[model samples]
Target: MKGLFKSKPRTPVDMVRQTRDLLIYADRSPDSRESKREEKMAELCKNIRELKSILYGNSESEPVSEACAQLTQEFFRENTLRLLITCLPKLNLEARKDATQVVANLQRQQVHSRLIASDYLEANLDLMDILIAGYENTDMALHYGAMLRECIRHQTVARHVLESEHMKKFYDYIQLPNFDIAADAAATFKELLTRHKSTVAEFLSKNYDWFFAEYNSKLLESTNYITRRQAIKV
Candidate 1:
C-alpha cells in the first residue's frame, strides 16, 4: 500500500541511534565488500550529514534551536562515544572527518543548564590516550588529531593529558617520518600546551627539570621547520 511506503520522519535520537549501530558494524567488518554493507555505509553518511544540519541550523536568521542541543547532549550520555572512538580508525577519509566533526561540535554544546560545559568530554578521559595512540596509524592520525584538539578544550581533559606519563611520547610523535602525521602531532602538541594556560604553566613548573630539557633539544632546535614553529607557538 502507498501508506506502507510512506517515509517516517526520524527524530534526532533515532538518527543518533542509527549512526551508532552502523559504526559498530563498520568497525567489526570494515573490509566487507558486500553491496548491502556498502549501501548501509552510504546511508550512515547521509544520516550524519542530516544530524549535523539539525544541531547547527539552516541559512536563515532563525535562532538555533536549544532543543537540538539538548537532544544531542542526551545522545552523548549514551554509549555513542564508545562507538565513535571504535569506528574512527575504520571509516573512510570523508566519513572519518564528519565523525570527528560531530564530536567537536558536541564539545561546544552544554547539557546541564550552562551554555558551554564538558559533561561528555569529562566522562571519557581515557579517549585522550587512545587518540594519542592513533598517531601510530598514518591513515587515522588526522581525524584523531582533530578529535583530540576538541577534547583538550576541556580543562579537566587537558590537565589529565598534561599529567599523564603519555606526555613523554610526543617527543617521538612530532618527529615521525610521515609529514602529515608529524604535522598533526605537532598541532595536537600545541593545542595541549596552549589551550589551558594555567594548567600547562603548573605542569611546566612541576616538571621543569626534564620537560624543558627535552623540549629544547627535540622541538625547539629540531631541523624540521614545522616542529620548530610549533615549539615556538607552544
Candidate 2:
C-alpha cells in the first residue's frame, strides 16, 4: 500500500506540529473544557519546576550557567504571572514555604538583577486576591509576615504592600489583644523598620498620625518594662 512507504510516518517534526496544534485548540476552548485547561496549567508548572532546578542546580560550568539563565528568561516570559496565581491555591504548606525560600535565594543570588518572579507575583491582582483570601488564618499570617519581610527589601514590593488591602490584616495581627502574636509582630516590625529605615520612615511620616498614638503607647510600655526590671534589680 502507498501508506506503507509514507516516509516513515512523516518524521518527528510532523508529530510535534500535530501535538502543538492540539494543545492550542484545547487551550482556546470554552470554560466547559476546564479539565483540559487545568492539565495545560499543570504542564506549565512542571516546566517551571524543571527550569528552576536547572537554574539553581549544583553544576557551575559556563554552559550550564548560560542554559539556566536562558531557561529562566524563557519561563518568566511565558508564565511569570500565571505561575504565581496557579501556584498559590494549589501549593501545599510545604510548597508555599519552599516558594518563600526560593524567593529569598533568588534575592541573594541575583542581588542587582531585579526580582522578576517576586515582582510579577506581588503585582498580579489575581495572586493578591488569593493571597488575601487566607489573610485571617494564623498559619497564613505567619507565612505572609515572612514574605512581607522579603518584600520590604525592595521598594516596589514595599509600595505594593502599603497600598494593598492586605495591609489591614497585617496591622490587625500586630494590634491583636493576644500578647504572643502582638509580641511576634512587634519583633517583625522592628526588624522591618531596621532594614528599611528610609522607606519605612517615609511611610511613617505620612501615616504615623494614623497609628502614632498606639505605637507611642507601646513604646512607653516597653520602656516601663525595662525600668521595672531595673528597679527590681536595685
Candidate 3:
C-alpha cells in the first residue's frame, strides 16, 4: 500500500533530471546514436505539463534550456520525420503548444538551424490540422486561429493552408454571420495571399464571388489592383 502511493512520484523532478542526463550523455558520447537521443527527447516531450510546471515554478529569471542540436538533426532524418508526423496526433493540446516553443528554441541553436527548419516544417502541418479542427469550436476558434497564424508566419506554413480546400471552406464558413470573425479571417487570408501570390491568384480565379461578397469592397479593389499589376507583368 505504501509502495502503491509512493508519494505520488516526483515526476517533474525526474523528468528534468532525465532530460539533463540525456543531454550530458549525448554530449560526451563519441559517435553517439542520435536516434536514441531524439527518442529520449520525444519521451520527455510527452510530459509537457509536468515540464512546464517545473519550469514556471523555478525562478522566472532562468530561461528554458535548448534541446540538443544532434537530437534535432536526428529528428529531421527522413525516418524520424515519419515518426514525428505519427506522434503529433497523439500529443495533447498542451504538448502541441509547447512544441512550437521548443522548435523556436531549437531554431536558435546555431548547429541545429537546418535540422530544426526541416523538422519544424513537417511538424507544422500536423499542428495546423489541429488548429483548424479547434476552429470548429467557436469559443476556441479565434484563440487557435491567432496561434495558427503565428505558426504560419514563423514557419511559412500558411502557403499550404491557403492552398488547401479545407481552409478555403473554413474561411467561407467564418464569413457567414459574424462580421468580426469574417474580418479576422479575411485579414489572415490576405496575409497568406501576400506571401503566396500564385496561390492567391488561383483561389481568386476560382472563388472571386465568395471573396467579393464576404470581404469589404475596398479589399476587393486592392486585390484587383494587384491582380492587374501581375497580369501586366506577365
Candidate 4:
C-alpha cells in the first residue's frame, strides 16, 4: 500500500527531458527577477548533478545499464547537446564542471553497441566550430577546450576539425600566454594530427608545404619558451 502511494520514479528519459527544459529556460536572456533567476540556476545545477550520477554512478551504487541507455538515447535525440554547450558559460563553476563531465562521459557512451554521440556530432558539425573557437575565449577556453578534445575522439570529428579552417588558428592558440589554455590547445592539436594516422597523412600530404610553413614561422620561431618547447613535439 505504501509503495503504491509513492510517486513513480522518474525515468532516465524523464530526467534528461527535465534537464533540457531547464537548459531551454536558462538559455534565454535574464528578464526575470534576480531571485527567480538564482532559483532556476540552482535547479539546473541539481539536475546536472543528477545527470552526472546517472552517467557515472554515485558512491552508493554503480550505474544501471538500462537507465544509462535510455538517458544516452534521449540525450542525443534532439539539439540537447548543442543547447548544453552554448549555455555552458552561463552556468556556475560547479555546474560547468558537472556539465563538462556529463559531456565527456557521453562521448564514450555506447548505445546499442554504437557511438551515437558521434553520429549526432556528424550532423551538427558546427558545434565543433563553436568548441574550437573556445580557445579564443579566456573564460570559456578550458571548458570548451576540454569538451572539444573529447569530441575529436571520433575519427570523423577529428578529420572534420583537421580539415576545417580552425586548424589554421591552432598555431597561435598553442602559444597563448595562458600556459594552461596553450597546453590544452597543444594537446588537442597533437591529437588531431596523431589520432588517425591515415587521415592525418593524407591531409598533411596535400597541405604539407603550407602547413609546415606556418608551423615553422608561427610556433618554431615564436618568442615564448613554452611555445618553442611545444613546437619541438611536432
Residue 77, model 3, lDDT: 40
State every prediction's TM-score relative to the real structure: 0.87, 0.54, 0.44, 0.96
Residue 228 of model 1: what lDDT?
A: 83
Among residues 3 or more apart in sequence or in different chains, the pairs in candidate 2 whose N, CA or C atoms overlap within 3 Å are: none
lDDT of 3 by residue, 1-234 (tens): 777766656543355455445444434453657787567556646544445443333455453334244444433443333333234334446655664444344334444335355346655576567566655655555545555555555434765676566555553544435555544555555566665667667777987886566444333333545433322322
Deviation (Å) of 114 in candidate 2? 4.6
lDDT of 2 by residue, 102-146 (tens): 444443333136555555545554544444444455556555545
1 versus 3: better TM-score goes to: 1
Number of the top-ranking candidate, with TM-score as the measure: 4
Q: Please give, for residues 1-234, the per-residue lDDT of candidate 4 as tens digits.
A: 888899988888998999899889899847988998899889989999999999899999998888888999999997889999999989999999999999999999999999999999999999998999999999889999999989988989998998899999999899898999999899889889888899999999989999999999999998888898988885
- The CA-based lDDT of model 4 is what? 0.92
Candidate topping lDDT: 4
Residue 164's lDDT within candidate 3 is 67
Per-model lDDT: 0.79, 0.48, 0.50, 0.92
Tell me the tens digit of each residue's lDDT in model 1 across 19-51.
Answer: 888877877775777898888788777877766
Off by over 4 Å in 2: 1-52, 58-64, 78-82, 107-134, 163-168, 175-188, 216-234
Which parts of model 3 have CA positions greater than 4 angstroms off?
A: 1-46, 49-58, 68-111, 115-120, 123-127, 154-156, 176-187, 194-210, 213-234
